[model samples]
Target chain A: MGTRQRIVVAGGSLAGHSAVTELVGLVPEAEIVWVTGEPHKTYSKPALSKEFMQARNELAELTLPDVAGDRPRGLRILRGRSCVSLDASGRAVTLDDGERIDFDQLLVATGAAARMPGMLRGVDGVFPLRTLDDAVAIRARLADRPKVAVVGGGLIGCELAASVRAFGLDVTIVERLDTLLDRPFGGALGSYFLDLHRANGVELVMGAMVERVALEEGRVAGVHLADGTEIAAGLVLVGAGSEPCTQWLDGSGLQVGDGVLCDAHLATSSPGIFAAGDVARWTNPIYGLRMRVEHWTNASAQGRAAARNMVALATGRQDLRKAFADVPYFWSDQYGQKIQMVGWHEGHDRVELDRSGDVPGPLARFYRNGRLIAAAGVNAPRVVMRLRRQIEDEARAAEAA
Target chain B: MKIIVDRQRCDGNGVCMGIAPEVFDVDDDLYLHVAETIPEDPELRARVRQSITSCPILALKLVEE
Candidate 1:
């Protein structure tokens, strides 16, 4: 049947996996060839920082819909194959093993990977919390009440330290910034969590940078600070941010700004090619902003959107230009508190509401042009819901005007 | 016609109830709770359908006669 209109998907993480799953649903008759850099079946990315830290086997069980299943009919799964080059001129993708497959349409769901500070290869006790392998390595240190030290006060670091401490491991957080999650929440909410983490018995070392990791007998022994101080720890987890997986696209003739530059519809500059998930630099319609987010919500939504748009482009249906306007939301479980944020409030000119007065519910900080642009809460899902509606209302008014 | 929502897709954003409160409301998990008592206004059904169309995840579907 003329090769069934070949569709190829790269990267087998949540975004890659979900995009493949939705693409099969969107075009059942299409021949699917999904390639993943990893050899194993896919699983949920969110569980890695949360649930997978507790155990490793459950990480494989969180697969949304087995991409390797037969319900997708003509879908083909290729594990341990990395797409090293995107040949737009040839209408094919080149694998690392020097195999090329032609496709009618291509979805670049290649997600980002976490940054490992310096070289983690030879560093004793260096760890990063990103993939299942990272978690498995970190879990190995939990034995024998190891003294754990986590660098970077970001969401992953804080959550990982908290979870590690729950296992009664002596854990401490060393952040270069003065507080945790500072970029997302600013220093105010970050300091709040700094206190919470200390109260939970996890030591907090704010405003410190690790100059180097100390090693003895080829094992991580401690971290040496820039100010000539060393903290002893058996395990070290670096929770710094991630870098987009767009290095392979270098000189590929596709414009790469913060991410693969796409318009509202997640379409790349080249025809029959689209990018999404952590690698897609999406424009936020609500506040006229652009960001590349690695959150699960962003990955799934953008993956599904990219899939539909690819289907539309292949089928010659031009109505797939609708952009994602959903408010950015993030959640972090630390120190027994669920910190949730709806909408972007960073660099806000004004702080409209600061409800620290309310201990737990609606304990939020809102910002806008004399309006409420965002809100954060602890056990305040309802308020976050209301704030989401408010942001949507503002977005619609802005579009209409 | 009635609007039905698939709870699994709802992340508790509450966009459905915010646009058309007459037909949809938030449940405990903050997903849409459709009214069983039929509302006479056909326009509310249309609005809910519109909201469903805008949902990033196609969580809402309309059952029409």
Candidate 2:
């Protein structure tokens, strides 16, 4: 056999971990070096909000099954090491400790970091739920179900509120937008969620910007809004959003926008280096648009696609390369209801309630320029499934046209 | 192939039903059930396997009959 090539993967989250697994399966003889900033192995980040808060498993149940288990002979994981710089010209990376490692192929799946508001930057009890450690820290700070104030009414914020409320704690959700989940689900579903949270005893503070975090003895006492209203709370969680983890590649000369811009094949600006997951902003050929998705399903699919492309490039079989395109799918659990969405609904001109027949929730469909673009449903799983297939079919027809 | 679902692990996310409607169904009560105990054909068997793997919670599993 010829000399094996070394493949270095940065960020041991779902995306990087999935890439390493795919690489091992695709090219068994390749030498794999996995670099992760965290100490533990890959775990289900989605489970952090859904499971970690309600029950105190300490993240034992959230770990991804066998991601860091037995290796495939040439696989080595460098845990607790972060990539500080990338030398694209030299095809290498400098770790936080200044150790430079050369690679035949590099996959940057650094994922994203939780976005914290400027006012609450150094405030204690202001937690962002992104990693296992974040979840653990938040849980440790919650003592005896103190009043919990969650900033941002997005998916993570709502889910976290729902999970913590299940512990019989008084929870409040503060959102800057007029309605919750309006960007993706639109007004109808957003109002529905507003009602759901209210019905479940969750206080909603909408259309108000948080001015600053109230501090008492160097800890979070509550949040003060711009309108001079203050909500008292013992703990605060800021789930505003997430930004791509690409600051380490500042001078790498790669096309960095909201994320690392990549082609349809998940290849970055630099050759032999690819990106996947939330950090990868690629133009999806299927949707005929560019988007950077933070969904778990997208991360898994992109990770596998990036790994296959890397293997093809290394084996000198460029002809066998495939484009990365999958319909985006995500699910959030809140208030005993399962919210599922398939396809992109942004910029849709019309949204219609397709079904509301006492199925506990409604199924909504979004259309753009007379073309079905997306669909979302609450507790109507089968309808959402059928709509996803329809969206896939429509996307294929559009691609063909 | 025989289909099995771990009810404790299944959160009724509907991922399985979305992948294979013939084999899995999530009711309005947010409960997952096997619509078809056995896949009628080879194509359906493939889809059931896909559903099993697509389940985010890893609640669904396939067993050889």
Which prediction has the highest DockQ against the true structure?
Answer: 2
Error of 2 at A12 (Å): 0.9
lDDT of 2 at A355: 50
Candidate 1 lDDT over A84-174, as tens digits, reads: 9887767888899999889888888788888887744458678787776877777776765789998888888888988887787888899
In candidate 1, which residue ranges exceed 4 Å CA deviation? A1-3, A68-71, A119-121, A318-321, A356-362, B1-65
- Alpha carbon deviation, residue A163, candidate 1 (Å): 0.2
Clashing pairs in 1: A124-A220
What candidate 2 gets wrong by more than 4 Å, as runs, is A56-58, A316-320, A358-360, B1-4, B17-27, B33-55, B60-65
Which pairs clash in the backbone of model 2? none
Clash totals for all candidate models: 1, 0
List the RMSD of every prediction in angstroms.
Answer: 5.1, 2.8
Q: What TM-score does structure 1 among the candidates reach?
A: 0.85
DockQ of 2: 0.49
Report per-candidate DockQ.
0.11, 0.49
- Could you say which candidate leads in lDDT? 2
